[model samples]
Target: MILTVHHVTTYEYDAPMRGAVQSLRLFPSRFDGQRTIRWDVAVEGGLRGGNFRDGAGDKVEGWSLRGPVSEVTISAIGQVETTDTAGVLRGHREIVSPFAYLRETSATWIDHALRDLAETAVTGVKEPLDRAHRLSRAVSDAIAYRPGTTHAHTTAAEALAQGEGVCQDHAQALIACARAVGMPARYVSGYLFAREDGAPHEAAHAWAEIWVENIGWIGFDPANECCPDARYIRIGSGLDAHEAAPIKGIAQGDGSERLDVTVALEAVQQ
Candidate 1:
């Protein structure tokens, strides 16, 4: 399947700022499951800076804008060809050890409830792959998908206790549960094509990936209750949502900032 994406993010400050700096992980990943066709990223009135692939194999680019400017916009447009690998991340190159993901982040911190859930889900399940699938299923069963029920800063424990959240919370909760079972897991940010069932879903999405002993990293979308397939376009990953965010930046000024984002994904005609 071929997917085309258009994503735009805008920042508006009440007062003109002196400058702004941004780090972007907006490019698609390189792997057997997905190949980049054509991609471009641009920032209006911004200067592009150092760009490189991080240890985790995601492309990172820097940008800066000098101002007195009150508004800035970043846009990314791309096409990618993807194949279903049953959520297995094959042929992606990265030097970071999977164990590095075992380190907990504030967003994915495990509590007694998470530990118990992990243990109960994996109990009597021996195969690492099976354990991972069980964990994903457990999280899916635990959290009801509901938008606006939680905030960006909500932690895994809080989400689990609340029993309702969006994709980000589901991904983080799954990450915390996976780590509780001694598995290395990380959060993934990307785009998901509209479901065949026509269910409502955000074009921009988040998921979790767990390291199976022999399987490397495999993606699991508890929000969708399935493994990633051709409909999924890989972008970037990190220990939590903040790290995996496609855009991270700081604007110079005391002026308050308002952000608006829009993303659209569609299947390309063959």
Candidate 2:
């Protein structure tokens, strides 16, 4: 399948900021599952800086904007060809060991409830792949998809306690549970084409990837209760959503900031 994406993020500050710097992980991942045809990222009134591939094999780019700047806009446009690999990440070069993902973040911190959930989900399940599938299912069963029920700062434990959240919550909760079972897991941010199942999901999506002893990192979307397929476009990953964020930036001022984002993804006929 061929997919086209248009994503724009704008930040508005009530009071002008002195300046801003941003790190972007908006480029799609390179793997057997997907190939980027053409991609471009631009920031209005900003200069592109150092670019490099991180240890996780993610392409990172830096940008800077001079102020008194009240608003900043970042745009990413691209097309990618994807094939279904049954969620298995393959042919991706990375130096980071899977064990490194075992480190938990605040967003994916495990608690007694998460531990119990993990134990119950994987009990009697021996295969690491099966254990991962079970954990994904458990998270899907535990959290009802409700968009506004949680916020950016909502943690996995809190989302599980509330039993309602979006894809981010589901991913974090699954990560927490997977780690509880001694499996290496990380959060994945990406884009998803329209679902034939009519499930509610944004074009931008988040999921979890668990490392099996022999299978490597495999993606599991608890929010959709399935493995990623051709419909999904892989992006950068991290221990949690905050770390996997497509865009991270800081403005050198005390201005109150508000953000707005819009994303459109569609399948293009080959």
Off by over 4 Å in 2: none
lDDT of 2 by residue, 102-164 (tens): 998899999999999999999999999999999999999999989899999999999999999
List, residue by residue over 1-270, the lDDT tens digit for candidate 1: 999999999999999999999999999999999999999999999999999999999999999999888999999998999999999999999999999999999889899999999999999999999999999999999999999999999999999999999999999999999999899999999999975367978999999999999879999999999999999999999999999999999988899999999999989854
Candidate 2 residue-wise lDDT at 133: 95
Per-candidate TM-scores read: 0.98, 0.98
Q: List the residue pairs that clash in candidate 2.
A: none
Return the lDDT, model 2, position 26: 97
Clashes of each: 0, 0
Q: Residue 136 deviation, candidate 2, in Å?
A: 0.5
What value of lDDT does candidate 2 attain over all alpha carbons? 0.94
Angstrom error at residue 180, model 1: 0.3
